[model samples]
Target: MTQSEFVNLVMPFKDKLYRLAKRLLVSTEEAEDATQEVLMKLWDKKKGIGSYRNVEAFAMTMTKNFCLDRLKSKQSGNLKLVHSNYADDRTSLQKEVELNDSLEWVGRIMEGLPEQQKLVLQLRDVEQYDYDEISEMLDMKPTAVRVALSRARKAVREQLIKKHSYGIQ
Candidate 1:
């Protein structure tokens, strides 16, 4: 893809991509960095992007892999590092805390999902990809995509119920 074509094709996807990264990272700064990194990657490989069946899905996969790496390292041996990832919020930030809290909960719920469920849910819910798009991206049949999403939704509901019962401390 040419520079102009790539820019025009991808500029509109920024917000959606950023939101998906934020859902994965739970930190605005990290999400912003990931978004820039993903965009930079696409720009750097503009020639190769045309070979992919779906560039947006490819970008989302990149963002997810980046966040998953961070999460893994944080869980491995970086207590302070992970805590610090979310420590720099400004007092006067415009976003309501409640919204962030909700996203965080949903993010955790998503993290707990099985690998297939999580990817399917992120594609379908977070990225607004329909079943066919999701199936195409994940190389699953549309019926399988629907079944996985249904089961994943039920699992999330059950986990939420149990968390509530335990007071979610």
Candidate 2:
């Protein structure tokens, strides 16, 4: 494909790629590098890109694998899960503070979850990917994706409720 065509195809989901990378790598710089690397890889394969039935899914899979590999590497010792990507300019300061605190607690709880559940939760809830897309990216069946997402949400909800109702961490 030509450069413009490639850009048109990728621009739609580029943010999604970066978000997934950030979710996995937990560093903005690392996520940016990963996104650039994935885009480069896709550009190199532009000649055959049309052959893929769903390039977005392929790119997402690439992003997922790339970030997972980075996490598994020796240099990943400093990486950790953190979620700070929320903003609401219209909200009052008190509301914003409360929202940030809740989000922070959710992020901490998510850190304690298993890797699969974490990934499922991030893909489904944070990234807003559909079941089929998440399944394709993570190589799980749709039903399996649903189950993982459900379990992840349930765990997060229960933990948040416990923390709020009984003052337990």
Best by TM-score: 2
Off by over 4 Å in 2: 75-100, 166-169
Weakest lDDT window of 10 consecutive positions for candidate 1:
89-98
Per-candidate TM equals 0.65, 0.79
True lDDT of residue 71, candidate 1: 69
> In model 2, where is the ten-residue run with the lowest total lDDT?
82-91
Q: Per-prediction RMSD in angstroms?
A: 6.4, 6.5
**What are the per-residue Cα lDDT tens digits for candidate 2 across 43-92?**
99999998999999999899989988887872455533322232232224
Q: What tens digits encode model 1's per-residue C-alpha lDDT throughout 1-169?
A: 6778988988887787787777666678988998999899889988888798888777766777776777677677655565554434322234323335655666666765766787777778767788877776667889999999999989989967865665545
Candidate 2, residue 7: how far the Cα is off, in Å: 1.2
Provide the lDDT at 103 for model 2.
69
